[model samples]
Each structure stands twice: as C-alpha cells, then as structure tokens.
Target: METTPFFIFLFIHLSCLVLGFGSVMVTDLYGLMWIRDRVRFTQVISVSGVTEKFIWAGWIGMVAAGIPLIILKGEIDNLMTIKLFFVALIAINGIILHFLHKKVGKYKKGEHVPNLFMFRLMLSLFVSQLSWWGALLIGFLHRHVTTIINWPDMPWLVSGLILGAFLMIWGLGEIYFKVKEV
Candidate 1:
C-alpha cells in the first residue's frame, strides 16, 4: 500500500468517525438535557434534525474509506470481523432511529409523548451507544494492540449475542410500558 493513499484513507476514516460520532454525542446530550428538564423536547428534536445530516455523512464516508483501508492494510482478523458486524448494526440501527426521529417530530408543543415512544427512544439510544462505542473500541483494539488482545473465535456469535441483548432490552421495555399503561 502506498503511503499517500493509506494516509488519505486513514484521515477520511478518522474524520468521518469524529463527525458522525460527534453529532450523535451532541444529539444524545440534548436528549439527556430534555429528560432532565434543562431543555425542551422541541429543542432536542431541532438539534437532532440539524445534526442528522452530519451523522449520515460521517457514517457513509467512514464506510467508504474503510474498505480501502482494509484492503490496503490487508489485515483481516476476528476483531476486524467483529468491527464490521458492529458497523452493519450501526447502519441498521440508524434507519430505525431515523424513523423514530420522524415520529418524535410530529408532536406539537406541550403534548405528552407516548410511553411507547419514550421507551423506544431510550432503547434506540442504548443500542446506538452500544453499537457506536463497541465499534470504536474494537477498532482501537485492532489497530493499536492487535497482538495483545484475544478476540473471540466466532465473530458471528459475538455479534448476535450483543444484538440479541439489545433486542431483549427493547422487548422488556415494551412490556414494562404496556404493563404500566394497563
């Protein structure tokens, strides 16, 4: 791999990570602010609406740059596989979050948000944090301490267990909200 191309791809990859993850972090902070009554739901939605573009741009660019980096480096191990799985989960979760954002946007000021919506939003936030941070951690480990860390043998099983736990949490949330309403 040429040094110039490798550096270029790495730069784009890092830039995308910062842009996307930074936007997501800001949006989550605003959501927490709303939950804490430090800000309004409308304000949180506004910030999310604005930052969504950057989030998507960062995700897309990161993925685009990642393929070349993988090829250039020619290092694919169990950890890399796990990271890729996490990236795919992020994409899937992003789509679900986008729709949830749309649903949240429909409420007028002062209207009570539904319990289900709140629960789902919380679930999405949890999943987002898990996927994003998990991917970041896996990438860092693979890049920095490849020889030290012992990655799991079955990457699919690991991915499945992580996603399954998230889904279970979401299902439990749904049940809790339903029971509360009853």
Candidate 2:
C-alpha cells in the first residue's frame, strides 16, 4: 500500500474538518447566546454571515480531499457508507440553512420572527450539528474501531440515527416554541 497519498489526503480531510466544525461551533454558540437573550439577534446573524464562508470553504475542501481518500482506501465499507451518508446530509442541511439565513436576515433585532421560521432555523442548526458530529464519529470508527470490534451494518446504524435525530428535532422545536411563549 502506498501510504504517502493516503496520509496526504487524510491530513487534508482532518484540516477541513477542523475548519468546518470550528466555524460551525462558533456560529451555534452565537445562536445560543441570541436565543438566551444574552446577545442581539443581529449579532448572531452577523456572525453567521461571516462564518458561512469559512464553513463552505471547509466543506468544499473536504469533498475534494475525500475523493482521493476513498480512491486510496480502495473500498467503501459499511462504516464509510455511514460517513458518506452524514456528509450528504450535511450538504443538504447547509443549503436549507443558507436560505433560512436569507429569510431570517431581514428582521431587525427586536422585531418579531415567525414561529415557523424560527423553528425551521433551529431545525437546520440541529441538523447541521448532528450531521457533522455523525460524520466525524463514523470517520473515527471506520479508521480506528471497525477492525477491533464487530459493527452493525449501514442500514441499522443509519436508521437508528434517523429515528434519534427526528425525535430530537421534534423535541427541540417544542422547547423553542415553549420558551418563546414564556
């Protein structure tokens, strides 16, 4: 096995992960502060706007690097499939978040934002975080654990996550609306 190419792509992949996840974490933190009334909504929007570039840069880089990594690895196992699933979900969620940000950006700091829109925004954020974390975890397990322990097949793992994410999204929306009502 020619490890040089694999190691190069791995480094690139890890770098992109750090950039994307770090930017996302910052954006989510800002959003949390806004939701808690500790920061102005405008500030959150501003931060998100700025961080979006870095996020996309990292995303694009990851895809670019991932192709070579996959090729070098010479096979996609169940775990790799799970990681790919999460990557796809993250890409789709990012598109939704882009539009949601555009819609939400119109409101002033103290102005009313519709419950539906707010819920969607929260949902998008949740999806983004979940997908990123899922991909990261799957990647780690694929690299480090699959050989050491027997793992469930792709459908089982993915289905379980889908169910869990669905429930969490519903609960998060309920909590967001209830907090707003208070």
Candidate 3:
C-alpha cells in the first residue's frame, strides 16, 4: 500500500504528543524536586514556564493537524478508538494543569489557601503528568500493534492495554485525592 497523507499527519501528531508530554513530565519532576528543597524554586519555575509554553504550542499544533488527519482517514478501528480516548484524556489533563498552574502562581504570590486545597492541586498535577505520559504511550504503540504482533504473542496490543489500565488508575487516584482533600 502507498504511504498515505494520514500517515504523515499521524507522525506529526505523535511528535507533538511526545514533545508535550515530555515537557510536562520534565516540569513536574522539576517542581517536585524543588518542593522537596532539593533544588531552587526559581530555577524550577523558570524552566516550567518555558516548557509549559512549548507544550501548549505543541498541543495546539496536534489538534489542528489531528482533526483533518482523522477526517481524511475516516477509519475508526480499535487502535484509533484507543488513541482517541487517550487523546481526550490528555486534553482533560491539560485543562486541569492550566488551572493548577494558576493556583501555583497565586500560592507563590502569598495567596494562602487551606492545606487541603494545596494538596488537591498537587495531586491534580501528578495525575495530569501520568495521563499525558500514558496517552502518549498508547498513541505510539497503537500504530504498530497488529502488523508486528504474532498470533499468540500480541506484544503491542498487550502493552497498549496495560497503558490504558495505568491511565485509569492515574485518573482515579486524581479524583480520590481531590475528594479526600476537600
């Protein structure tokens, strides 16, 4: 079969997904380290601000490209379904992270909230990273599963399922933490 435009678009979309997720992970890890007093908060904040901006740009690119790519392809199989689900999850997490970043700014500026609220926000960030990472993994693997899988081994499909389970756990833990905080 000829390589389709959809494949090109998918490649770009995946590239954005990787960049966005990787940026978030780096920022979150840096923030965590700073929180633990192992690094300078100022450094973490600076890096996070830069990375977050890049992530947002990448996300916008992905959405802009993905719409046409999905429509053009017009084939929603199991892998596509799995990819879309995780993409939605990543978008949701991005929204939550936007607000969480705002809260973190406010906190930095001496806006005090209940400790519970802070804890909830922290948990949200954690879950956001987890979901973002999981989604990227699913999206990447879904493209390769069937073609590479043996009749019994089913390597890629099995990994995708595992990733999906991890995504669910991440989302549930986020909700649980938020509720407990409140």
Error of 2 at 140 (Å): 1.1
Give the runs in model 2 whose Cα sits over 4 Å from its true position: 147-150, 154-182
User: Best by lDDT, which number?
Assistant: 1
Candidate with maximal TM-score: 1
Better structure of 2 and 3 per lDDT: 2
Error in Å for residue 113 of model 2: 1.1
Q: What is the TM-score of each candidate against the true structure?
A: 0.93, 0.83, 0.66
Q: What is candidate 3's CA lDDT for residue 14?
A: 74
C-alpha lDDT values of all predictions = 0.87, 0.82, 0.66
Itemize residue pairs with steric clashes in candidate 1.
none
Q: Which candidate model has the greater lDDT, 1 or 2?
A: 1
lDDT of 2 at 119: 80
Model 2: per-residue Cα lDDT over 1-182, one tens digit each: 24998888989999998998899999999998877889988888889999998999999999999999888777777666666777887887889899999988888767888786778887788878978988888788767766222345555566567857776876878787788877
Q: What is the lDDT of candidate 1?
A: 0.87
Q: For model 2, how many clashes?
A: 0
